[model samples]
Target: MFFIYSFTADTPPNICITGPYKTWRAVIPADTHSLSPVLYCSGCEDHVSVSADQPNSQMETDEPQSFFAAFCQLLFKSVRYICIYIIEFFTGPKQSLKGNHSDNKVNLVLLGMSGTGKSASGNTILGRRQFVSRTSSVPVTTECQVEETEINGTCVCVIDTPDIFDDEIESSVKNQHVTKCKQLLQSGPCVFLLVIQVSRFTDLERDILRKLEKAFGSKAKEQTVILFTRGEDLQCADMNLEDFLQDCNSDLKNIVDQCGRRCVVFENKTSHKHQVTKLMQKVDEMLNKQQNQ
Candidate 1:
């Protein structure tokens, strides 16, 4: 007597089956079945009876076939790896706005009152018009904005934020802006650019450093760089950066001193690259000092 065992795609409904085993049939003679009347499924411990006379007798095979089992196992592994690759291709690695501090990326957050040319300064640093900059009586940037660029092979991320220190703005809204800026930092090293006009310091900006500390915590002043915009006004007065700072009022001078005397002047109207270069140098030096401490 002869007995035939068949396997189908849906026959072995078990999790142990790893591959598509469809229409696989094997023949066994009843005389041979007396020694081993049962055969186990490939990659599965479940056994099937192939008895002619008793039809319910189950036994295990001493040795199974090699080539067919090896093929199924190899196919399953190949399919699994292909799926993993496809998933990784669609959802790539995660990256922050400026990347981590270990990557040597610079994150510059521009903070100041309105009409201080903060957006213009951001455009100048990126060498492009990334943020909207125009003269207006009210604030132009109403939300936190970010732009990134590569400077001398160093990655730089510039975050332009609205005037959160304004009394008219709601505290909730101001908190939202601060929260967004912190999220962008991604726990990396950051330098705040406290933008101030060259010749247009107002009473509103007198206690700006204190406001910055309140918003960004105590370490704000230590990691800050005084960015003075509208350098053309200084040029028209025939005054250089050092001369202007020397003649500045005691209040402004004190603010600059508290920021470790780190400052840079930018003439946004001009296309000069030296001013941006100077600002990046100041930022790099401040970051290095912070790292050392």
Candidate 2:
């Protein structure tokens, strides 16, 4: 018999089921903003008893272990349904949560169409202009480029890919770009940052996501986040980020939803390091959330 809990971006959700079978304790942390208020379904016929952890001693029936098993089955089913419900209910088509964390670790894959600030974000993350920057419209990233930098004592492998979604470009060039991204992901866990301008979001952004799905498979969805360039422009001393996102453009909102509502806007043209630190903090939060869940 078992019970399960799931996590989503909306609610500070994470639950751990521990202890002996019938006496197992469900720890719902203070920040867990659960979607449903009810955990113990009162209608189940498994001779089960339930009570709020805070309100009373657990309401336990003198039911057999097998009786608890039936209730456990119901509980497991509820958790499974809720997990998918949260993602589908709120998660957008373009953004998604990063995948499970393991000992494999993760690298960063900076991807997007030309002029979306991929190279700039890479430089901001690595604390240097590791790749060429230009004003021309043509995709300068003729091939895949790989570089590794350390951030906060962690090895940050940054891989830059050419515009794979470029239709006018040569097919060979596109395929080479895709190959580089894959090779990098193969080395370890990868966080693909879809760099884009903060001033605007467009259909081209969604189109790029579809291209990524085709080239890298759905697995990439879990490991991707939208890095909004020119974010420092939007920062406010009084307004919170949640408000900013709520008031953002539909395209921006869509991208935010895609990356599991995770965002880190930055001012790439400036020489501030706080933006990179914020990015690291977001990644670390993601890891810690997965671990606690």
Residue 289 C-alpha lDDT in model 2: 69
lDDT, candidate 1, 123-158, per-residue tens: 999999989999898889998988998887777889
lDDT of 2 by residue, 1-293 (tens): 34446565565343334325334433222322432222233334323333222332343545544544445434534554444455555553432233344433458888888887888778777788888877786767666777887665567788887777766777777777687667765455567787877666766665666677877887565667778776665764444457678887776676677768767777788878888888876776666565767
Top of the candidates by lDDT = 1
Q: How many residue pairs clash in each candidate?
A: 0, 8
- Which residue runs does candidate 2 get wrong by more than 4 Å? 1-105, 170-172, 235-244, 288-293
TM of each candidate vs. truth = 0.65, 0.58
Task: Report clash pairs, candidate 2.
Answer: 94-258, 95-258, 95-259, 96-258, 96-259, 98-222, 99-222, 106-189
What are the Cα lDDT values of the candidates?
0.73, 0.63
